[model samples]
Structures are given as C-alpha cells and as structure tokens.
Target: MLVPMPSEPSGQTPPASSLPGPSLPTPLPAIAALPAYVPGARGDAAVPPIKLSSNESPDGPLPSVTAALADAGGLIHRYPDMAASELTARIAAHIGREPAHVVAGAGSVAVLAHLLQAYAGEGDEVLFAWRSFEAYPILTRIAGATPVTVPLTADARHDVEAMAAAVTDRTRVAMLCSPNNPTGPALTTAEFEAFMAAVPTRVLVILDEAYLEYVTDPDVVDGPAALDRHPNLVLLRTFSKAYGLASLRVGYAVGPEALIAPVRACVTPFSVSGPAQSAAIASLEAGDELVERAHTVVAERERVLAALRADGWSIPDSQGNFVWLAVGEDTGALVAHLGGQQPSILVRPFAGEGVRVTVGSPRENDALLAALARWQGRTG
Candidate 1:
C-alpha cells in the first residue's frame, strides 16, 4: 500500500497521517534549494566585451594534446579505462607523489565536489572565505552541509586568522582558493603554515591552486612540501589554466591515501573521458614548454594592470592569469555598459561589482584597454 504523491510543479510531499504511506524518503531540502551555476557569457552579442571571464587559458590546449585526442578517437567507442591509471601515474610523478596518493577526475571542480560529498553532510559544517571561489558554497550546500562563510579582508585576500577562528568541532573541512578566483590574490607560505597549525587535525584543509601555474610569488606555498607534514592537507591543481586544456576537462588531487581513496569511491567510474586522459598525459610530457606560457600571461597581466591603474581604476594585486577590477558599483551595469562597444569584451562581474578580466593575447588585451579608456571618459 502507498500514499499518492501530489503532481504539482512544486510537488509537496505527503504529510504524515492516520493512513499508511509510501516508504520513499523525501529528497534533502538543501539539495532541492541549491541554485544553478551561471557560466560566463560568450559569442558576438557582447559589446566591447573582451571576455576576461572564467579564468581559462587564453592560448588554448597544446599541439601534443590535440594529437593525443586524435589518437584516442578509436578508443571512444568503448568505455574509458575506469582507473585512468596512466594519467594518474603521470600526475603522481608530475606532483612528486606516490600514485596511490593521487586521483584524477573529470575536472578539479568535480573532485572538489567529491571531496565535500565524501566528508560533509547534515550536521557537519564546511568553512571557506565568502569571495574565494563561487563554487565552494554551492558544492558545500549540495553536499547537505552548512557553509561557514568568513568574509575576506578589505583588500580581498583570505583572512587566514578569521577562517581559522571560524572552525569548530562540527567543521569537517576548510577550503582555501589560492590566487583566489575573482579576487586574484594568493596566500603566502608562512601565512598558510601558521593557519594550518591552528586548525584541528580532524578538519580537512583544501588548498585549491587552480591558477598555480601563473603564480610568480616566491613566498607561495609549495603544495607538495605541506603534503607530508599535514596528512589532512589536500592540494588540487588543474591543466585548464596554464596548460590551455580547459575544454578537455582534466584536473587532479594530491592528498593522503585515506582522503584520496574515499573521494575516488564517490566518482562514477570512467567520469574522466578517453580524450581528456590522453590529453593530460601529453600535456604533462610537454612540461615547461607547456608551462612557460604562464610567463607571457603574467607579463601581459601586469601590462593590463598598469593600464587599468593609470586610468584610475582600483585593481588588486593579482598573481593569476586574470586581473580584478574592484569597482564599488553594480557589476551588471558595468558589464552591460562595456557590452555596447566595438570589438566587444566580456568580464565576470560579481555581487558588489568586482569584475575579473582574463589576460588574453596582445591584440585582445589592446581591445579591452581601448574600451576601458572610453569607459573612463564616459564615467568621468
């Protein structure tokens, strides 16, 4: 015997009553309430839009990666290798960790979700800075966990001390996005070390270095160096940014075997596609030739920053491939205003008007600069 479920657009679950009811449990309220992710805009409709949105590699994937993808064409008819053994091994060697300590996922973001799902749930708390990565809170909520958002300091860098203070016995994880997305600032090694020391051993600490390649700061935390000392520390990196493999969707995690294994269990088998695995391997082999592109992006990012500052915009100290324009206005207005100009440009604008612009080729960068100059004239 079963109770009937109402078939409305906003279906209401049957209330407890004197009559017998269906045993099916209702879906978690948190899961139902999560918002859909809004990806950055693209295509010609955008005006003066030099899309510096979504911190992707401006140069695109490597030639070897394209060749590997071609080689994998025949293999696509069959399911990909479930383990992604070769890619995992190459990633382990690349990160100087044992293969058992690494896990490959469809993307770094997917792995981050897996980590949260594996470790967090109702009654558990996940802590991170408010403006770190937009995905952090979404993933935390999706995992049925409470999100403890500590606002970033005035300059828009993670206030490590504040984040550390927010942790409680109920906290299962603390996530830090270095060279943090949108803001483009990174945590120094000493600051991170001290912060880690303050956090309890039970809580997992995630250092997401998706933009590690573009980092030129000598004081940046070395992901591997902290791994041995802090078994709870997990480092996530991606080929999407500097290696120019965003479309391929491959990223990896390096952590203790305990943490790595559970997250691996949650991943649906063969989530990483055949072409993605092949391309990642090829990119790893290419080494510095693939990584050296960061130099160009870093150099160009500075040039972009200089131009923005000269025009009287407040720009943050960005070590990533993108620059953050801290305009204390509505980002939608700024984005729309920029969208009406020629050789259009697009940027990722957030809640309070912080816009992130990617460092593109010289020509694309010049286009953005011209638009900014015009925008300054109008606003002045």
Candidate 2:
C-alpha cells in the first residue's frame, strides 16, 4: 500500500514510450475533410531562383511604405490600434465611402473569414465558383457552414448564371472573385450585374478585388462603383498584391454599415499590427506611384501572354498581374522541370488543373519564357 513508483536508473531517464501520454480533445469532423492550402514552392537557397509564384510584386513595397514601416518600428512595444481608425479613414477617403462602412483586417482573407464567421454557421450555406480562391471552401467549413460550389466555365471563367442558379434558401453568402486566381479572366460588369439580379437580396455578395490594381480590362466589374446599388454587396480590397505589403498583411472591406458592424465585431482585437496600418496609410498616400507600378506589371503580363500563345499555349485573356497555363495532367512534370533548372523558376501549380505564373521583372520574365521554351522542346 505504501510502495513508491520505481525510480529511473542513475544517469538514465525512462524511455519516452513508457510515459503516460497526454489526453487531447478531438477536432470537429468537418476539419478532417478540409483540404490544405498549398502555397507555391520556395526553391533552394544556394542559387538565386526566378520566383514567379504567389502573385507578389516583382518590385517589393513602395519607397513610402518602407519609410513608414521604419518609422513605426520604434512603436513595437505598443499594441496596434484596435479600431484601425486611421487606416480605415484613409481607405474610406480613397474609395469615397463613409468610415463607418469600412473595416480593416490583417488581410482580405482575414476580413473574409470574419464575414463568414459573422453571417454563416451550422445549417447555412456559402456559395462560390469552383477552382476560385482555394481559401473559400476552407473558410466556409471553418465557420461550420456548408460550402456550395458551382463549376467554372470551360474558358476558366466564372459561370455566373450557374452560380446564381445554384443558390438556395440556405445560401447566406456568395463570393465573386474577379480576375480569379489560377484562371486570370475577370468577371465582366454585365455578368456581375445579371448575377446580382438573379440572387436574392438576403444573400450577401462579396466581390473580392485583390488584383483590381493590375486589371487593364475596361469591362471588369468595379466593386466600389456598384456598392451603392447593391446594399448587400461587400467590396474586398487588399494591400498585399498591388501595394506590395504582402508581408505586412493589411486589407479592407467596404459595405453597408449594418453588415460591416458585425464583420468588425468578429475581427480579433488588435490583430492589425501598428506597422501594417502605417504602411497602408503610406501606400494610400503614394497612389500615383502605385498606379504607375501596376501599369508596368500589366504591360509585362501582356508580353508574357503573347509569347506563350505564339509558342502554342492557349492561355486565357488575363486582366490580373499573372498568367495561367492550362497544362492539364502535365502540371507536376512541368513544375518539376522548371524547378530542376540551374536558377529554378517557381510557379504555382494546381496539380491536374493548370499553372499560375506571376508577372516578374523584365529579366525574370525573360528567364521564365526561356524555361518554357526548353520544356516545350523536351515534351515534344
């Protein structure tokens, strides 16, 4: 009755296998079903690689943004503005919206997640196009809501009519990703307006314009301009892509004050760091310079697309800062071949779907074209 637990031998600890394991709680069943969001591969560090992955700006953050970040560095000990007041005001001013109608989050993804959390839950459904942003279904499931997806058209564009037809009584949110990821064609204004007419007013519509800055197409849906007409509409914009603040993570949503209030409530307190807010405000101030840089990327995108088409690749008309190559089952082989090169080229591959190549600097773009030429030769 008084026996003590046996002690370990001198200078030796008991085997980890013999220890009593900690009990852990089980996760939601839906979590296991969720697919992982695979980011683009980062090539080896020994050699400098031509990285055209992640749709990031070839030229990093703007000069003004960098300067603001440097100035904000001294405030590292302090917590960020919980309301993100200054940045919110700047965004509202930039978009000609009221401050009360705007809410800022770490990034557009975070803002979108908050929106889902606020409006969707068990028994509700969130709708979006298939093969759009990979995060859509993941975030929808995380909110304990059912994800209803409509397939993209054969041209790799949003089948708006199909998406609108798929909406049901359970549908609480519908997301439209203009200039959709991996498949770069944007949703036209007429297509969007027709879809909006078909959808019920109760269902919230989110227009994700993350690549709006790089869009050269005149007919693409302009989210902010249409916000006045669709009270249920929410416009999502990010500083990550065109503003080149991917590392800092700042994005905003503009919508009706009533809906925005709930989205703001769902955001984690002080999640938007001080430096990020400062950089975003600085980025807003440098609007002209940002526009110039975006134009540069758009020009390069056209050049790359033209070259690819001339080389027998049937690419969609991309309005975003990237191009999509529908390589079908050859995705893995093409990705490997590109990565296996001396100065490897990194592009986002969607297994059996296609590859997304970011518009890089002139030299980097040339390198990518050269790599494609070599691959074509080998495959033929």
CA lDDT of each prediction against the hidden true structure? 0.85, 0.92
What tens-digit string does per-residue lDDT give for candidate 1 at 142-257? Answer: 98899999998888899999999999989999998898887888989988998999999899999999999888889988889989899899999887888888887888889999
- Top candidate on TM-score is 2
Report backbone clashes per prediction.
11, 0
lDDT of 1: 0.85
- Across 1-380, the per-residue lDDT of candidate 2 in tens digits comes to 46555788889888877865558898889998899988867777887788898999889787788899999999999998999999999999999999999999999999999999999999999999988999999999999999999999999999999999999999999999998987999999999999999999999999999999988788998888899899999999899999999988898899999989999999999989999999999999999999999999999999999999899889888989999988999999999988987788999999898899999999999999999999988887
> What are the runs in model 2 whose C-alpha is more than 4 Å off?
1-22
lDDT of 1 at 289: 80
Q: Name the candidate that leads on lDDT.
A: 2
The regions of model 1 sitting more than 4 angstroms off are 1-27, 45-49
